[model samples]
Target: MKYEKAQEILPQDLINKIQEFMDGGYLYIPKAETNKRSWGDSTGIKKELNNRNNNIYKDFESGMKVDELSNKYYLVENSIRRILREHKKSNK
Candidate 1:
């Protein structure tokens, strides 16, 4: 799937809603069904983390070890390893 930046894909209405949340002193965006899915949830940190993990796994499968990739990407090797471990356990 091709990823588009949030500023490009988010409609004006959604942008307004996000601004409202921010203005109201809310650091986290509230989950709301703007279309078929919750906009806030779809663009959240959890989704970003999952995407990073998938990319890491792909690199690992292509002959890059966890430590090497983690060093190159400036990510914590142990954290990436744990994420891979949990992902494997969940798929079992």
Candidate 2:
């Protein structure tokens, strides 16, 4: 099942964290809460994405280049690039 828009479904604290990342030019969500109902039957894809995004943040923070980081994680390179670009723009 498709995930709902973040603001609509995420808890307040999670939403705040997500907003903080977004404000800093990252697009990420936290690991799904176990008690909360998920958008779909827990396929685990969203959680996996969250983990991958977290890894991306860690790598980025360590001074890894987007292309190298994306290659290492097997993720969509454009998404990482966009997140970095947006983050820079938002901070300005």
Identify the candidate with maximal TM-score: 1
Clashing residue pairs in candidate 2, if any?
Answer: 25-87
Q: Which candidate number has the best lDDT?
A: 1
Q: In model 1, what lDDT does residue 18 have?
A: 83
Tens-digit per-residue lDDT, 18-90, candidate 1: 8765653424434466545644476797788778877777787789988898896688989878877877777
Q: What lDDT is obtained when candidate 1 is compared to the true structure?
A: 0.73
**Candidate 1, position 22, lDDT:** 68
Report how far residue 41 has shifted in candidate 2, in Å. 5.0
Q: Write the per-residue lDDT of candidate 2 for residues 1-92, one digit (tens) a residue.
A: 35567668778898787666565454544666866766644688877876667677778989998888878978678989876666556558
RMSD of each: 10.8, 17.2
Query: Candidate 2 clash total?
Result: 1
- Which runs in model 2 stand beyond 4 Å of their true positions? 1-41, 83-92
